[model samples]
Target: MMKEQWVKDLSTIVNPQDVKIDEPLKNYTMTKLGGNADVFVMPSTEEAASEVVKYAHLHKVPIFLLGNGSNMVIRDGGIRGIVLNLSKLDQIRIDGTTVYAQSGALIIDVSKAAAAKSLTGLEFSCGIPGSIGGAMAMNAGAYGGEIKDVIVSCKVLTPTGDILELSKEQLELGYRKSIIAKNGYYVLSSVFELQKGDQETIDATITDLTFKRQSKQPLEYPSAGSVFKRPPGNFAGKLIQDSGLQGKGVGDAEVSTKHAGFIINKGNATASDYIDTIHMVQRVVKETFDIDLETEVKIVGEDLPTDKNKTL
Candidate 1:
């Protein structure tokens, strides 16, 4: 729980105007179905973000580092103490063949910027919609290319507020995970080394990928992207389709008929509905194929309190 004093304290770390009390999380998330955040702190700089973390660490306050909410699901109870975001820090720079991007910058925008400069390696990520920080933490990839392939290094803040520059080898990126996630570090910025390439070829690749993604995915509705990870020797979408879960759902959340890999929120869906749909798919897949379906989405925040409000 966030106390009144904590709110005032956070204002000292950043601009008081940016410190919001009981802010609705639904406005920030892609699902549009979460409870209010107790205290939302949008810091403007890396130093300010570090100060807030250090304060939280010393005071034992529960804190959450919020992203742009493309790959996450926030529960109805919302977040407890402080929720920190670095949206104001968004900046992307291209110097020759290397790219420098702040943590809050959109990765899609970064990819496009790189392509504009005739950089080739980032074309694969042109369609990935996520913050640079989130992408770095997850080693975001698409179309047979991943962030780990071109990442040179990143500046990250440790859980205790110490800053460290991590090399790609130290990042330990593997299969939708990285050291940043394991150590709970907050990424400030990252540098990627790209190569000069033909401008026409890069643009063509992005166009083709964008088309394939739009045609195959359930882009009409809101979703947390692919719900489950690719299991060894098999794909999650194929397995879910084989299990006959498409279009089946709980409340307003349904397994997308267009793509079995995604669970879509068909307007007015609650987080509970979305989560239940995920469990339902997992249960069905397990029973049908005897293989566990590991979730790729990051499910967080608190469930609604048990009372009359509870509904299936």
Candidate 2:
């Protein structure tokens, strides 16, 4: 399967407009960083998405499923193979007290939809920046609630392009982790069971939570949310703050002055700057608290190429 043949087949199967070559990743991610993607595809339907996956599997081309690009950081050197943007798969439906959302649907949108229907469980997600698929992959949570609490089941596309419906237990969701991510499964959609509630109460809750998030987080800058997972029995932000690493940075990537947990792109920051700042935070936190702060945000791709003629 040559690159040209694969692209041709994919274009024929799906719409030609949806298939793009050497697409810049900066336009897709929240951080507004990253280099170009060798190939980028947006599937308007599940059938189209499935076809793309099947072709990628058959060709042995690495397939990367991108959600809203909220919690990810691609390298300056860019990604190899195909980058599948699920943004076109956005769909939302309600049956009884359960809400079914496609992978590409924003979590906040889902929460708002639930609130409109007077559903009670998803108010916490109103401020979450990632898509539903990304949320399910990481069991995204905030304000004392998480995806695991509301999720009943999910539809996933396996690495072999086979679709499977998995129960909550099968997902094995944990603190910012799930079996889908562990097993390289792509989330297609999910069913969430919710309780009946007053619409006013739900809307109020969402508004309050949104305000809290805006006040605390560095929303003015580009960032991948909380950069480090909470260390056991302690918060990562507290650890970084205690280490005197707040407002510190490497290049343009700074430990957010508003929230030490976040590594923000102040202005014109490169992927290397972000990576360097992350490493610095980890080193200082480890030295100060004897705790190795593990990253919550996903970093992918190769490093930027340097000029061979330059000397150190």
Candidate 3:
């Protein structure tokens, strides 16, 4: 738990009910494996969220910004200081040809909203399961499209609590990386400019992509969406499959037999189990192909100290 005075101070800025101490993070993450957070605050509005950030900055509390928790893994040792969850900030609005979404809005929900308005550019994101903020932070993509392709500008709250609207060029969006991520800025909202398209075409595109995702990815099990980024010219999944590690298992964590790219929780999987599996896959792939696999999933927090030293 955080200092009582700090918690009480933050409660005055955000909704009192939204504040929690020693909150388990597994329930919020996509992989459903993590320890607790010292303090968790879900602000209902952008202003409230900014206020929380300001308070943390003034008090010298380390603050972690949490979106939908899709492409991240919080280690077994609980995170210290304050964790700001943006889940309550979800709000998507359509204005003319532009779609505005609060940082906490799910990308799939934004795609659906755009589709309802016959917007064509966001079709590729219909199957993405991250929040708009996280997608922007990592320049998230799927099926040949990414956030960089459609985004115009975004509002962000700096670490020092200053809010600024940044253009696409300033965002410096690249393959699974962005300025927002490198600078540790908190995304407040994003504005996307999309073209008008036939409603049938938009719906069909979403359907086709949805089918591809459902068919190729292991959606049945709990796992972080793609364990590693596409390594250079080679696909991570293909490399792992070629290395004969498709069905590898470490405790309750297993490489998906259906898709080598994912490490799934086969019931009762600990964060350690998942981390070990990822390491095993990386080691095998590196040894066989001489390719260092870089992880797309963000692993943070401390590790649990154990007596056993298991080498991959």
Top lDDT: which candidate number? 1
Compose the digit string of candidate 3's lDDT tens values, residues 32-59.
9899888899999999989999999998
Better of 1 and 3 by TM-score: 1
Candidate 3: residue 274 Cα off by (Å) = 0.6
TM-score of 3: 0.97
Worst ten in a row by lDDT for model 1: 1-10
Report lDDT (CA) for all predictions.
0.92, 0.91, 0.91
Which segments of candidate 2 are over 4 A away from where they belong?
A: 1-3
Q: What is the clash count of model 1?
A: 0
> Which is the winner by TM-score between candidate 2 and candidate 3?
2
Residue 40 accuracy (lDDT) in model 3: 90
Lowest lDDT 10-mer window, candidate 2?
Answer: 1-10
Q: Write the per-residue lDDT of candidate 2 for residues 13-48, one digit (tens) a residue.
A: 778888888899989989888988778899898778
